[model samples]
Structures are given as C-alpha cells and as structure tokens.
Target: DIALAFPNQPRAAVGEVVTKAVERSAPTAQCTAVEVWLLAGGVLGMAEEVGAETKDEGPAKKKQKTTTDMTSARLRHIMLKFQDGAPKTPDGKKVRSKAEAETLMRKIMRDLNEEAKELKSKHRGRKPEDYALKSERFTKLCKEHSECPSAQKGGAMCGDLGWVSKDMQSKRGGNFRELVAALRPGDYSDIVTSMEGLHLLQRIA
Candidate 1:
C-alpha cells in the first residue's frame, strides 16, 4: 500500500509500473490505478462583448491527471508523551546523534583502513571481518532511525551530507553511499557487503 509520486518521468512509464504493482498485489489486498492530469481541454478561450464568443482553436490536449491511490496502511495511535533527543540502545544507553554518528563512522572507517593495512601485511587476502565492520558502521544510522526509542530521532530530517549535486537527479541504484545520497537527508539506508548482490535497505523517514 503505497502512493509513489514519480517526478520527471513520463506518465506512461509510471502507469506501466502501477499496473505491474496492482497485478502483483496479494489476494487479500486490493489495488487501484490512476493516471494523473488525464483530461482534455481546448485552447484558451476569449470572451466577446455581445455575448459569449468561441474561437476556433486546435485540438484539445489531454490534461495531466496526477493519480494517487488510497490504501489501508495508516497510523492510528497518537502518543501524548513524547521525548526528544537521540534514542537509547536496548540497554537504555544513550545513542549517538547524526553528527556524532558521522564522526564515529569516520573513526570506524579510519580503524578499518588501518586494520585492512595490517591484514594485507599479514596475508594477501581481504578481511571479511573488516568488511562487516564497515557495513555495520555505515548502516548504524538506518538502524537507529528505525528501531530507536527516541521519538524525534526518526525521519529524513538530515539536512545535507553533500551527496548529490544540483545537476544529477535519478532514482537508479548505486553503491551503498550513492543509495544514501539518492534519498533526502536523514533517510535510513543499509550497507550490506556480499560476494556480489543487491544491498538490503529500508527507508525510515
């Protein structure tokens, strides 16, 4: 149950994707498709002083009907007691903020670099443990934003990480860092290193 708003793509392309989504819906779940701004109108009309005048304009272009569907997924509970600040771990320890998280990530990266150098010196193979550490540190932001206890901590509120420039814009997938960049800042994403496979990611904002 999702209403994905696609910008900059042709309406036909979106409609095709929606049709696929609807067809793939579970038996118990219903789905609908809509084409946005699908309308027809003639050229701009002009009025006459005598009465009403109609100018002979060319054929009317179809209106752009932005289609959106409604589904059953909705939040119902409204908790009056809300707390601010970063969430705590399961042991009730304070978690790190975004800035702190980034700093810690950099430290982790540095440590990993040193560890990789050591491993290369000791043996001529890559370190699985080091790769795991890198993925874990990179994905920490996503996890905290997902299951963290803090109320105000979640969401894509991260202002900027200088990931994307103004010129580049597309929804294509890339490496772990690029995936995070594709989203608005503070959106949760994961970095999973496998032999070679798609990375597991979850949006928390």
Candidate 2:
C-alpha cells in the first residue's frame, strides 16, 4: 500500500541498526521492484491487448481493427494475519500465532460455505441473480474476522486497492492478483495462504 502511494522513488528502511531503537516507520521492501521494471519492463510472459482506435486507410478502402475491450472488476476480501515478524496491522497491533490465525480463517470459510448451500436450496427455482452469494454475507463476516484496515468499511465496494496494472502486480508478491482473477463474480475464493496472511476473496464484479 505504501509503495503504491509513493511509487517511482527510493524509500527509507525501517530499523535500528544503531541499536536501542524501536524501529518505527517501516521502510517498504517493495521499493526495490523498480529494479525489476528497469530489467524486464513488465508482465513478461503474456500479452495484453490494448484496443487501438479505428483509422481510415486510403479513400474508399477504409479499414477497421478491433481488439477485445478490457473490463475491470469489484472485489472484497477478509484477511487473517499472524505476527510473522512483519509489521503490525493498520491499527498498530500484532496478531497471534500462525496456527491460531489459520483456525479462524477456516471457521469463517465454513460459515460461508453453509450460507451458500442454504441459499442454493432456498432459491433453487429462482433466478441466479436473486439468490447468488455475494458481498453482504462476506461483508458481515469480514468486519468480525478480517484484520485488514478495509474491514471497517466491510472491505469497501472496490477494495480501495485502486487500479493495478499487470506490470505492477508482477513485481508484487503473495500471488494475490492472480488468485483474485480466478474467482467468478459473486463467488468467494478458497482460503489463500500468503506471506501477508490468509485471505478469502470475493469478486463483486
């Protein structure tokens, strides 16, 4: 998050090499990713089609080309973090052990699964849109379980993650953007284990 806010610049390190320091103002490790961009340029492996505007060729031989139009999505998530030697949460508190964090994440997932089954049976003959599992259930659980600061807003509508380009996400870790892309709209992801924490992702779009 800090890296996104302060992109294209060198960042300070957070520590007490001098000793007796509390090591406040954690420096972002992500700042080094600029070096990768300087080398590979972007999301190296795949090609993303950027639509080009139609143009006229000769006089009456005007031609047109249309690439696939890109679209965006809305997403929300619940995260359970442990004190893994990383920094504290946005609220400036440390989490418990990893085992405890995983336990809580599983419990939340189980509850969500139950809700999905119930909703399925109850609305069998109705339109999918009317009964599809979506944000509300997850939002309720998120407030109670997620440690992410966005929890206060129930993960917020757009996740407050803003626009992330393929190039940007390539340098970022946690495989978060990839996992999120796999989910269907209105569907929640399985428990995701990453360096940051365990998470449940819900695609609102």
The sequence of per-residue lDDT tens digits that candidate 1 reaches over residues 75-170 is 100011112375776899775543343333333333323343344345434333222222233334334332323223323322122233222212
Best by lDDT: 2
Provide the clashing-pair count of each candidate structure: 10, 0
Q: Rate the local accuracy (lDDT) of all candidates.
A: 0.30, 0.47
- For model 2, residues 77-157, the per-residue Cα lDDT tens digits are 778877756676799876577656655665576566567656656666543334443435666887777777777763344
Off by over 4 Å in 2: 1-72, 85-94, 125-136, 154-172
Q: What's the TM-score of every candidate structure?
A: 0.22, 0.50
Clashing pairs in 2: none
Worst 10 contiguous positions by lDDT, candidate 2: 38-47
TM-score winner: 2
Clashing residue pairs for model 1: 36-64, 36-65, 36-66, 36-67, 37-63, 37-64, 37-65, 37-66, 38-65, 39-63
